[model samples]
Target: MPAPHGFEHLVRGDEIVILHHGVRAATLRGAKAADFLARIDTEDPQLLMARLTGNYRRGNERAARRHPRNQS
Candidate 1:
């Protein structure tokens, strides 16, 4: 089956990680994995974190860019 949306993994040495955007949302031990999965799958988490950090701009697509690698 396909992996859930917004779920991604990383491997380094002996550990594995799950991330949402660049945030370290979970590890193999699964402490906050449920909340992280729920948060990312159901919400615009990059936008959410931007809002929380007072970095959200109203209707600002410029921040998301238009380059192929940076496009939303």
Candidate 2:
């Protein structure tokens, strides 16, 4: 499958990193999307740290608050 748009690939040491809009999204030491997703699914510490420091949760919370279904 083709890589996601707005994402660029980079190699660092033995790992491959995916940069989305110039920010890192995923990384795989073996350079495979499946590995990347699996690592993310397992909540690899590095990925978790990145997500926590990044805007992922913040953006999701904002969206949830805006959705009508979330209104009480």
Candidate 3:
């Protein structure tokens, strides 16, 4: 997928606050926060933030489930 837009992160002491479209999405703490900080510089920041906030799944999951290809 194309790199997501409108995703941002903020570091607050021991916490990393993930935001999507100017709204709070997820909060990473301790190890998670550290890990995110480590990877943020090396990877696609927007995509990483989207995944961290569990916002990567943007398609219609319910429709995909009902598609003929998905039928048992």
Candidate 4:
């Protein structure tokens, strides 16, 4: 099946690599490739990454432990 609009995909070993602007933006294994390919461009990669990996929290105390938002 073809990738949804705005996405280009390639198969490397056991992974399907999704590229944006020629960068290695994301990779999906065979099982999830179909699910990802069904998505539209309205979804942002950053948000999808956060949802799939659960590691993109933006406001955790550790996230700002050294770099305070009010730094002058």
On TM-score, the leading prediction is 3
Write one digit per residue (lDDT tens) for candidate 1, span 1-72.
222344355555444465666677645434344444456568775554443334444654765586578855
Q: If both were scored by TM-score, which would come out higher, candidate 3 or candidate 4?
A: 3
In candidate 4, residue 36 scores what lDDT?
61
- Give the lDDT ranking, best first: 3, 4, 2, 1
User: Which pairs of residues have clashing backbones in candidate 2?
Assistant: none
The residue pairs that clash in candidate 4, if any, are none
Please write out the lDDT profile of model 4 over residues 1-72, one tens digit for every residue: 222233455678777676654666678887786676556255765455444543344555565666766466
lDDT of 3 by residue, 5-33 (tens): 89988889899888888899999999999
TM-score of each: 0.31, 0.39, 0.79, 0.39
Encode model 2's per-residue lDDT on 1-72: one tens digit a residue.
222245455667777676767888767655464455556657554444345335333346667888999898
Q: How far does residue 15 in candidate 3 sit from its true spot (Å)?
A: 0.4
Identify the leading candidate in terms of lDDT. Answer: 3
Q: Candidate 4: where is the Cα deviation over 4 Å? A: 1-14, 18-27, 62-72
User: What does candidate 1 score on TM?
Assistant: 0.31
State each model's CA lDDT, in order.
Answer: 0.51, 0.56, 0.89, 0.57
Please state every model's RMSD to the true fold in angstroms: 10.7, 9.0, 3.4, 8.2
Poorest 10 consecutive residues of model 1 by lDDT?
Answer: 1-10
